[model samples]
Target: DLAAAPGVGVDRPRSPQPLVTAAPRADLVIWAPPDVAAALRPRAEDFGRTRGVSVTVESVSDVRSALQDVTAPESGPDVFLGPHTWLGEMEQQRVISRVTLSRNQQRRLAPKALAGARYDGQLWGVPYAIANLALVRNTDLAPQAPQTYEQLIANGRRLKAEGKVNRILLQSTGSTGDVYSGYPYLRAYGGGIFAKTPNGQYSPGRLVLDSPASLEGARRLAELGREGVIQPDVDNTNAVPLFGDRHGAYLVTGAWSVPVIQASGVPYAISPLPALPRGGKPVPLLDVDLFYVSATAQSPKLAQEFVRDCATRRDVQVRLARATGLPPALTAAYRDVAARDHHYAAWFDAGRDGDPVPSVPAMQAVWGPLGQAFADIVAGKDPQHSLTAAARQISSDLP
Candidate 1:
């Protein structure tokens, strides 16, 4: 008998189980950050072993390389794990197979996670971990968390003047962190990178970063940096050390930093990114990692079965939760040990209202110009001019 029951059918008697059972075996390939792989591999192996499947794990440093290997003749693994934003491009290239979720399964996921995995009206992946940016503040320095961007700026200035902190720790480096930290300001001012139609398709051509709201937000960000409230170095690596040392009062970071922060022995608290002027909420960017089956797999059926097993198994979800400080993509797993633990409880609360990052292929166009604009702003260029130029460049790059 197969160790796990099939998902589609009702429970039945075991008396008439198949006399001859096929050996359950699958290859799980992951293209993730090195730290993530180190944390998640053991749990994945244990989950596979419990189901009587032979599991093999391989790690790739980059998703592009993983995609190349999977699409190569005779080299593809049965399953792939990586960021959900890749779903849009992978679907367009027909390199991934879609997975259908039942109503129960759908309801179990955070709505933003569910929405992030859908591309062109089909669900292409199962979420493993969900991430969002938040305000990480040094408790010693910030007795009270600021509730608005204006307040953050005001408080940041006072902290800097008092020599209580080196800077506000915003990242303007050409990294994912830069985009995550910068986009919220634009959203707080009622601007967005892409607009979605009522039918759910995103129109990237309608880039609105040059709008008055976006320019104003950008100007505010630049002003904060210019006043020496924000650190001179926007490199993510540089900011981490400063934050860990409590040299900065607040830094924008994601759930991924939970373990790091705890290990650093700093007294800290996590809170929602401050709201914008006129009462709009700050929109934190969410990035989700997903599990997918390669379309070119030799045993597509078995591969999908493995995908289903990983997605619906409560035990697997719990193990994943404990292994990584990340919240499980499953709702039931939200109450598990890791989620309830002190280090992560605040992250779960902050993520409850987070926004999903745009998953359109055109999202790629925003990265280059956005990074340049942030760099220019930090270097003392006029925020309005830099943002306007970046928005025009993004519009020109849209497909």
Candidate 2:
């Protein structure tokens, strides 16, 4: 069980039985982010035409907030798309229902992606795509991928010395700090938000941010800060453009930024972020995008069939990957698309090697304190002391 906090819901165990009820027939409606809606429209139309089931896909400005009225008959869509992070709270609120997939359907998607859809031992959605951060090198500047973080830093320094680029790495360390971007460094030094069970479930009680290895990771981060590697001013808004403009030799970003970089006409290559000299491999955070059925859906059967059958098809997954620029969660579709797009392949590879963001409600408490601690370390605060304080604050914040 996760602790309840203001603005954050607590995870509650629910009966595993599917939610099936008597209701009038309704057109299956889906609310998706603009990009996903655009991708899903044609396929949805095809499904409605062939199956004689009415389907509508709405492009929403805010995908995350679309679930606030999930139980409202007039406002709620049958299905909604969002990251797996929402599973904890939405499940707690009973706004989303469990999705039952056949054995074949389960086997069609990537294992990690399916794992992301499960919360408290029940499937909640159908994962559509996987997103993870990777190293994007400006081929014009770096020319080759560095095998390790040390070599990357060394090359960055060399490039910096020649007055060719102003920034070593174009990554966001925003005003409040970005734990998502800083996650690789933390993992490389053996620090993580929580311990995981043998089968890979996050154990909320095992908060490890203040452990010895984590403090060492923080120390290394502060060392990089003092050495002028991690800059204080660079943020999410500017990092992409600065890298596109050749202001930086390398960029640590996700696949979503690829189109902008391509539009800038900068030659780039994608690869996983390198390991540290004496630490474990740097594992980026994986965020799986899923289509969740609303618990109070008017067309529950249609929504489940569409997500489980139509949406997971190879052609549909391929089209979705094209539109979203994310690797398909479907294994065969990913292999098909990855064969043609090296960039998407790199992202998929990174996601396979990365840690899925913990979907437990306790995770909400982690972002603020850990992010602030990272910012403080970058601002030259003592790593050990700062992390200790952060850990203490997070424990207090936990329910």
Candidate 3:
């Protein structure tokens, strides 16, 4: 496990950079996923005119692997935008560069975004979005969203009995299990897989998967499965189709599902993920997306400026939010966009309510066993015994 470190504000970049102005026709390359790529391409012309550098926004699939291949200092894109959780491995591999944001710059967005971007006491990127799982109910079918998991399941059972639906709620999972999907329930039951340090950051060395809270959470999982509330066969692939065809009354999913749900013509409303009947607030894993400067950038200063623009500009952030159907990282945009769209606002609130998973090396060990433990719980295995064994394995696997 990584040693507990100070709050995010040290480890400045060590590169010896020479001053080089952006040439009139110089290229400022940025790589992002297809949706993000589309959002950026339209702004390239305007950004280029303001910065005096021609911008190139390229779409790349599986950016994590692509980022690995760009270790050479002269060839990679100057900036790459992706999940903030990749900071540990990417930094160790020297695949990304560190960034220093002035207080004024930091003031442009919410503190959560800044906290999510920090790693080993330095900011590696600038966060622009926070994603968390929430409950989306087809209001036309279910009318009211359930405030508790039991209510949701009971509603599902009734819909099935009435011959109006085939399932109550469908969460994406498989035979192996889904740690991400089950996180909220684990948190709600008072058991979390990891503990937080004094600085409010995830502490990898402290494994608490076997805590009293977690065991209760496991019991809930077992109860759901044994009662036929969650089916082991429903994975991400089928969860969409089942929900799209209006066969399910609700979907426990993230912001990414908004576009598809809308396209399917379902009357949906987003709600805070329901709590446990035993008095647990549903706190899901918060996934923050950031724009990182590459260590290989030919013009580090220019790259930094571009990153600054991406982080602080309302127009840029709002455009991306409009394209992605997810909430913007800027609190300003959150309020502005939310005023017009309640769905986006609900997700933004949910993100603020969730806990962030640690971006540490030790976390890699927990995923395998924790997932299996969840799968076992949902497969009728004894929750107490399964969770105990998994917790033991996690403790032994810690670095």
The number of the candidate with the highest TM-score is 2
What is the Cα root-mean-square deviation between model 2 and the actual structure? 6.0
Which residue pairs of candidate 2 clash?
A: none
User: Residue by residue across 89-154, what tens digits does model 2's lDDT show?
Assistant: 889878789998998999988998999899988999999898888889988888888888788899
Sort by TM-score, best first: what order? 2, 3, 1
> Which candidate should be chosen as best, given lDDT against the real structure?
2
Cα misplacement distance, residue 351 of candidate 3 (Å): 2.5
Model 2, stretches more than 4 Å misplaced?
1-26, 69-71
Given candidate 3, what's the lDDT at residue 157? 91
Q: Count the backbone clashes (under 3 Å) in each candidate.
A: 0, 0, 4
Which lDDT value does model 2 have at 328? 93
User: TM-scores across all candidates?
Assistant: 0.83, 0.92, 0.90
Clash total of candidate 1: 0
What local distance difference test score does each model get?
0.66, 0.80, 0.75
Candidate 3: tens digits of C-alpha lDDT, residues 316-399: 788788877778888788777888888788887766767766777666677778777888888899988888898889888876
Provide the lDDT at 106 for model 3. Answer: 82
Q: Which ranges of candidate 1 are over 4 A from the true structure?
A: 1-53, 169-177, 199-201, 337-339
- Each candidate: RMSD: 9.5, 6.0, 6.7
Give me the overall lDDT of model 2.
0.80
